[model samples]
Target: MLSVNNIAKKLNLKVAAGNKGLEKQIKNIDISRPALEIAGYFSHYSSDRVQILGMTEISFFERMLVDEEREDRSKRLCRKETPCIIVTRDLHAPLELIEACNQNNIPLLLTETNTTNFFSQLSSYLEKELAPETNLHGVLVDVYGIGVMITGESGVGKSETALELVKNGHRLVADDNVEIKEVSNNVLMGSAPELIRNLLEIRGLGIINVMTLFGAGCILEEKRVMLNVNLELWDANKTYDRIGLEHKMVKILNSEVEQRTIPIRPGRSLAGIIEVAAMNYRLQHMGYDAALEFNGRLNNQIQKNGGLNNDF
Candidate 1:
């Protein structure tokens, strides 16, 4: 649960009144304006969110002063389970509102930012902090600015391949356990946990510090995952995509990413292959597809030859 005090500290909010209720938990990320509630409309009022009092709502309170209803309305608004109230644009809370908040033990926060800007920033922060996340047993690396996650069986040499890529100047984001967070609808950010930020574990070499040995250039704090590389032992019986015309994809957090299956065999430079794959993926984004071009040329040649098999 997120506390009102934590949100205030994160957003650098000033405490105006009711500091006692700063420990109140904010169970919902959605904030409330409460303009209608100030006008005595409580039919669809939601009280389980942070309430924002902007100039408009303050104006409504000012008009209510003539009717001698400001204090009563403010009391009614703060009577519910409202987590906290934020006065934006550096606006001072009305004396009656402050009294109501203090009377009900509802935290009152003040911020210099405008209402719209403050809401946008706060919503984004809450969205990321409350995003869904999962962990995968693999290695995430940044190759040529592309985030690639290497996954396979337990003994598929994921860590070794990541180490090789690090030696070749690629930065490692995470090793062994990659904590992935879905920041947005289609974006997944990969990072290592605090306990294993710069550590890499190889089978024979045990554990080693990639940041200390290869400097800061060989490690990344976090990266946006763009591709997945699955390494498997070479299986001659199964047919692989030799021409690369057909591509595969993997889904993570409801987002699909381009996936490549690399068969590991003796004398094969896995690091070089992975690096080239990253570059090729970037090329595909840049409107250049070698496999598609090759297929188109082959079709053109076959049509020119009247679809006849020319085997000399």
Candidate 2:
């Protein structure tokens, strides 16, 4: 559960009342506009969410003719489960609401951000912070602006290829272990653990800090993994996709990424192959497929010749 105090620190919110309740746990990502609750309706109130008292809600409360009714409604909105109350536009908190929040130990925060923008920002932060996450043993790098996750069995040279890519001006996101979070539907974000950030472990090379060796420009804090390249020792009996017509996908945390299995062999440039894969992925997105073009040309030539020749 994310705490109200953490949210305040992250968003730079100011405390107006109920400082004691800063430790309240925020379970819901949605924010609530307490317009109806302020008008004395609490039947369908979502007390689990953080409350937002914008200009409209504050103005409506001030227009209430009876003080006792206003106080009663304010008290009802400060239920125990309610995460906190945030007043946007730097509006003044009503005395009744402030007193009720203090009595109920519900925090009341204030922010100068517009209500709609703040709602969007807070919802996005909550979604990412509370998203489902998992860790994988791999190396993540940004090749030609595409996030590629290099995965394979132990001692398959994932780090060596990533280091080569880094030397060729690509950015390194993570090495050895990557933490992936499903922030939204079909979007998986990958990052390195805090302890291993910017640190890569290569066999017989010890641990090297990529940022220190290559500067900060070649390091990314996190990236959306767009491709997965799995490496393995070349097997003579295995059939590989030489035509690039097969579509492969790898699933991670409810999301799937374009996957490619590259067979490792001596004298082959893995870095160059992966770079071309990234460029090809961008081309495919832009409605151009080299494999499709080649197949179309082959068909055109065959059709012009009126069929295949038979040998006696």
Candidate 3:
């Protein structure tokens, strides 16, 4: 984990004689550029995690404070200690701002890059590092409450299958791009991105509204995945499962869900097969073990026939 302590130690190792700035002590950073107003907004809280992004191009930010005496409310909001303040774009710090920051012990970061790019990189890194392990994907749905995600080589009838499924009575969660988030432990929430919400595209049909064509019952905003049916083109020489024995799992967040691969071939109804697969998954979850039962019956028959080995 990258932390303020680590950054501080790195700074200590860098400058042989230079003093550490107030910005060096912050553990969590919030970036707000070209505005000191945010300092007044959340600055009252001593524990607040804030990083002010200052414009180095502006000279008006050099305002000074004659007396550090603060109001009673301000005193209560901010402790004697303050958070770090950062000035961007290699701008020179006015003596007043420097004095104020030094008095408050707020670390100041002065950099040479433009404010926009600096804040952008800071926010981007923090968000990526802190975000949950869910992904943004497109989901294919059907009438049987099956949450099938249509994914394959780009142009492989994924969205087309989903459009047909929706027309037949199933709902559409997200088209083109789906937003997946982990709200609680063990649960993965799936939703559609705003740009392509409730929309699906077919080769010849063009853009179509799932809700408008299929009615309200055919569109869903979000649903937890019960099974993952990977759609692959049918390979003539490739062996496929004739019986459900080996269990496949897809990991989402910290949880593992079941998976299956279905081959898409000419004259085959992929949407129907996907629905059936989902139904089979539900049945298995309800304590049905077809392979185990079949094996038990086979063993019993062998023993009854007096032809089984001693191991049986």
Candidate 4:
């Protein structure tokens, strides 16, 4: 839960203050409002917040708030509390105006790309992963202290597996959409999606409440993501990992996460496999590679057999 006002400070946006009376609420308020407010960079408390403008839009926005008759420099001076100003194309915003914004500490980001892509990405980041998360749905279970995310399309036994993991004494972090981010090079964290907070969907059962069913142990606010397991329909034809030799990665932002794809089929236990995978991944992270160990033993055997038996 991030307050929108706090976000404004983080983005370093300037608010034009058409009325100027609203400035006090903007300054003193300390509550998270993840929705979008004005356009520019996302200010703290606004939901889906990001500002976008064309030259014409800028002109109108500027003129709308200022007393302009001479030349309408209002366009250049309009934005008051935009977190950042992003200019597209080979454009100039006049020297004096640029200097004024710089003096006020507004970050003016320039990109060669259009406004569409910029807004798209910025919004996506703020919406999905950047915003603060509250864990109410699902559970954050620890498999030997490694955070494991168990999610599948619809049902496919996600929550049911989580129940087993918790019964096995693993802690639950979150269910449904796990908001993950690489905060640091060595760390990736997971939490719940805001809208569907603390809710898990079970096919043929509609939405069954996780927190209500399992109590406090069934809910987790957040956890560092050591690994991700995406459960998909089991494919008999596809070659599954029998040796854990190949490494898997899922890219989130600039960070690369170790990921495993587990096939789901009848008779195979999903939770058990995910638990094992999480343990194995943690071991690998700790420098214990099973494949490497196997290879070493194989090499030793070959050396003892006089180096590969050239004739055979």
Candidate with top TM-score is: 2
Model 1 residue pairs with clashes: none
lDDT of 3 by residue, 1-312 (tens): 444334434333221111344334444445434234323444534344544345532443334222342232223222333444445666665544555555455555565657777667666555443446455455646447656666666677778878767766677887767666554465565677688878887778788887787677778877765667777899999998867888988777776667788888899998788777877777787898787787788778887887776555
Comparing candidate 1 with candidate 3, which one achieves the higher lDDT? 1
Give each model's whole-structure lDDT: 0.90, 0.92, 0.60, 0.56
Per-residue accuracy of model 2 over 1-312 as CA lDDT, tens digit each: 789999999999999899999998887877789788888778999999989888899999988637988889888999999989999998999999999999999999999999989988898999988888999999999999999999999999999999999999999999989999999998999999999999889999889999999999999999999999999999999999998888899999899999999999999999999999999999998999999998787778778787654520
Best by lDDT: 2
TM-score per candidate, in order?
Answer: 0.89, 0.95, 0.56, 0.54
What is candidate 1's local distance difference test score?
0.90
Q: Which 10 consecutive positions of candidate 2 have the poorest summed lDDT?
A: 303-312
Pitting candidate 3 against candidate 4, the one with the higher lDDT is 3
Preferred candidate (TM-score higher): 3 or 4: 3
> Candidate 4, residues 1-312: lDDT per residue as tens digits?
333343345443334322222221222211222112222333343321233444554444354434332123323333455344445443454343455445544443344445556455545445444433332223345677788766456656777777677667676666666666654565667776667555666556677566677677656777777676777898888998877777888666556667787888788887788778887887888989989898788788788996766643
Every model's Cα RMSD, please? 2.4, 2.1, 13.7, 12.5
* Residue ranges of candidate 3 with Cα displaced over 4 Å: 1-137, 306-312
Show how many residue pairs clash in every candidate, following the order shown: 0, 0, 10, 41
